[model samples]
Target: MRTQVAIIGSGPSGLLLGQLLATVGIETILLDRVSPEYILGRIRAGVLEDGAVRLLDQAGAGARLHAEGLIHDGFSLAFSGQDHRIDLHGLTGGKRVTVYGQTEVTRDLMAGRAQSGALSIYEAEAVTLHDFDRDAPYVTYQKDGQTHRIDCDFIAGCDGFHGVSRKSVPETALRTFEKIYPFGWLGLLAEVAPVSPELIYAHHPRGFALCSMRSMTRSRYYIQCSVDETVDAWSDERFWDELRRRLPAHHAEALRTAPSFEKSIAPLRSFVTEPMRFGRLFLVGDAAHIVPPTGAKGLNLAASDVHYLFEGLREQYRDGSGAGLEAYSAKALARIWKAERFSWWMTSVLHRFPTMGDFDQRMQEAELAYLAQSQAASTALAENYVGLPF
Candidate 1:
């Protein structure tokens, strides 16, 4: 098979890139290691930044999102028995975030791609990327116990953290920066109503508790846990008890519990690979970077990468120049670093640091108190929460 671009993942990043490139008469074939239903079964991010929503709409992939996605104008920070609401829409001049899972986004994009009659190879595992230095690069893969080769003008690595794309780059051409947190998130989804109208980030004596949702009938919550905590260590009763201890009980009457549909743990970390490009092979989304989900920046950051990458490609071909690819590293890094800083800051504020001394903890509490009482501090958080411009 031959195409203009070969995208090595069928997740939102790769799917969205194919949709965007198709607008400019560029054809792409997306290869994924898993089936669409399996990919959609993995529960991930739930917040959609304003810019990300706009891009989806522009690509004609936001109809279901706009209809069913919940919009929130603000979120509350609860600490020391106080609730401080940061008006995101007010701070950002009407820009707000939407509550939509990454899984749903994948489903939507896949449907759109199928409707457009685009070429996508599901359940194809990318084996290697060859000849990326030449004008036409080729990617070899195995599907259904058979090997196939795909030739393309360029290659995009949109696979996750464990994929082969990052390793495909020569070690001498790679530079990496990363930080792993001492704690991870124990995420739970139950068939119950949400406890609050908007999301809440609570800091309590026990640990951090987050109140979020997937829909009006389903509640999604998270609590800070040791990075090594196993899911088998907790029962349904213990999970509820921990949630009650850390989460505010103001709406206890409204909160209901049903059998869990999904439960999992995610480690907290920040990662970024420099340059993000090497000749005809480029890395996008989790393949090039990762951030703790505290700031809900993962999916949006990935969308930002694909958008800029495609814009660069268009400029390259349209103007008969290579300047866009040359500048891809600096431009994408600027946004990536800002998001990394924000995610780190939010994670530190909510989670208990194992290495924190008494003085450091006290200072952190003092800062939280100030943020609740001071307008300037709250505005700063509001700005970051609503998202800084890409």
Candidate 2:
């Protein structure tokens, strides 16, 4: 097989890139180690920044999103037994976020790709990249006991953190920075009306709790837990009881309890790999960096990375120029670090640490108090929440 670009992983990032590239007459082949059904089944963050929304529109997959996605102008911060709203749209000069599930986004991208007659190979085994450092790069994978190779001008590593693309880089050339939080988020998805019109981030003596929704009737909630905790230990009743205790009185009163259809615990971490590019191979999304979900920057960050990579590739193909491609790593990282900082800051302020001392707890309270009172502080929070520009 031969193509202009060979994309590893058929997730949103990969599919979005392929769609954008195809619009410009660039041919791409997508390879995935898992089935398409499995990819669509994975649950992930839903918040979309304005930049992400525009990118989806550009990729021709924004129709359903615009139709069904809930627009959030603000979110509440619950602390000191009260809820304080952060006017995201007001503070960010009328910018707002869209609440649309990542699963739905992937589904839309898959459909778009199908309509465009793009080639996607799922259930590919032993996928590998070769000769990325040379003028030509190729990808190899196995299926049905036969090996197949795709020769392409470039390779896109849209695979996630555990993917082979990043690991393919020599350790000596890669510089990594990571911080693993001591706690994890125990999330539950229930088919019940949300407790609030918008999402709420609650800070209580017990821990941090979040009330979020995928739609008017499908709610997603999370409570902070020990890193060592298991989902099996948290029953629906216990989860509901614990969540209620963390919420303010009014919200707690309005909360509706139901059996969760999906329950899981996800650990928090901030990870970034330097120089997202290695010769002809460029890392995008989780392959290059990861942020804690506190600021809801995970998917947004991935979209931004896709934007940068797509722009670079488009410039290279259109004008026969390499400047955009050459600067891809530096430009993407500049925006990435800002998001990491915001996610880290939000996580530190909202979550309770087991090792936090009395002084630390007091400081956390003081920070929240200041944010609640100061318009400048609130604006900063709102700006980050709506997302920084791509």
Candidate 3:
């Protein structure tokens, strides 16, 4: 099969790219390793930054999101037994975040593509990429135990950190950077009510605990643990006991451990690959960069990549130019590095360090205290959290 573009991974990045391209009458083929529904069924990040929501709306992908997604004007930082609220809307003008899951976003993108009768294939594993320097680069993969090849004008590698597209790039052209945290988050979604009105980032003597949500009926929560810890090590009784300690007593229902629908430990890390574009193969989303969930920038950054890439492609097709493609890597990297810095900053400041001395712990407390007391510090945090400017 042949297309103007071949997108690997049907996640939000790939699906959104295909949808954007199709709107411009650009033919695209989207491939993924799992069934579309299966990919959409997984639980992931649920915060949508202002720029991300607008991009979705502009691409005609925000019907369901606008209808069902919750809009939050602010978030609270809880520490020292007091709450400091950052007015996201007030600080960033009208920019507000929406409470929408990544899975839902992917579903909307896929449904939108299907309505247009676009080519999207699931259960397709990319074996390798070839001829990236040529006009017609292609990807080889297997489907239903049968080998297949797809030729395309360009390849967008959105399959994520473990996918084959990254490896296809010559090692000499790659410069990798990463920082793995000593702790991971044990996140869970329960059938209980939310403890706070909006998301809460709390720093306690025990560790860092976050209060978030999936919907009105389902509450999402996270607790910091050792990177090697397993969910099995945390029993229901233990989970509730720790929750009671970390969460304020004002939290409803004595914090019973509701039946957990989803449980996973995501190790905290910051990762990036220089020059996101390599010839005709362009990497986006997790395939190119990763951010700790602290700032909720992962999905938003991926959406930004697709937005820029689509813009660049239009320029290339318009004036018969190569400048846009040449500049794609640097442009995308600028935003990627900014988000990476914010995520790293938030993670380092909010999370408790195990090796902290008295002075170090005092410094962390002082920083939190300053943010809680000063409007300037609060606004800085609010701007970064609400979403960096496009």
Question: Which candidate's lDDT is highest?
Answer: 2
Question: What does candidate 3's lDDT look like per residue over 118-169, in tens digits?
Answer: 8888887646789997877988889888899999889999999998789889
Clashes of each: 0, 0, 0
TM-scores of all predicted structures: 0.97, 0.99, 0.96
Give the C-alpha miss distance for residue 157 in model 2, angstroms.
0.1
lDDT (Cα atoms) of all candidates against the true structure: 0.86, 0.95, 0.85
> Per-residue lDDT of 1-390 in model 2, one digit per residue for the tens?
999999998888999999999889999999999999899889998999999999999999999999999999999999989889999988999999999999999999999999999999999999999999899889999999999999999999999999999998899989999999999999999999999999999998799999999999999999999999999999999999999999999999999988789999999999999999999999999999999999999889889889988999999999999998999999999999999999999999999999999999999999999999999999999998888887
Model 3: which residue pairs collide? Answer: none
Instruction: Name the top TM-score candidate.
Output: 2
Instruction: Give model 2's clash tally.
Output: 0
TM-score of 2: 0.99
Candidate 3, residue 199: Cα displacement in angstroms equals 0.3
Q: Estimate candidate 2's RMSD in Å.
A: 0.6
Clashes of 3: 0
**TM-score of predicted model 1?**
0.97
How far out, in Å, is residue 247 in model 2? 0.4
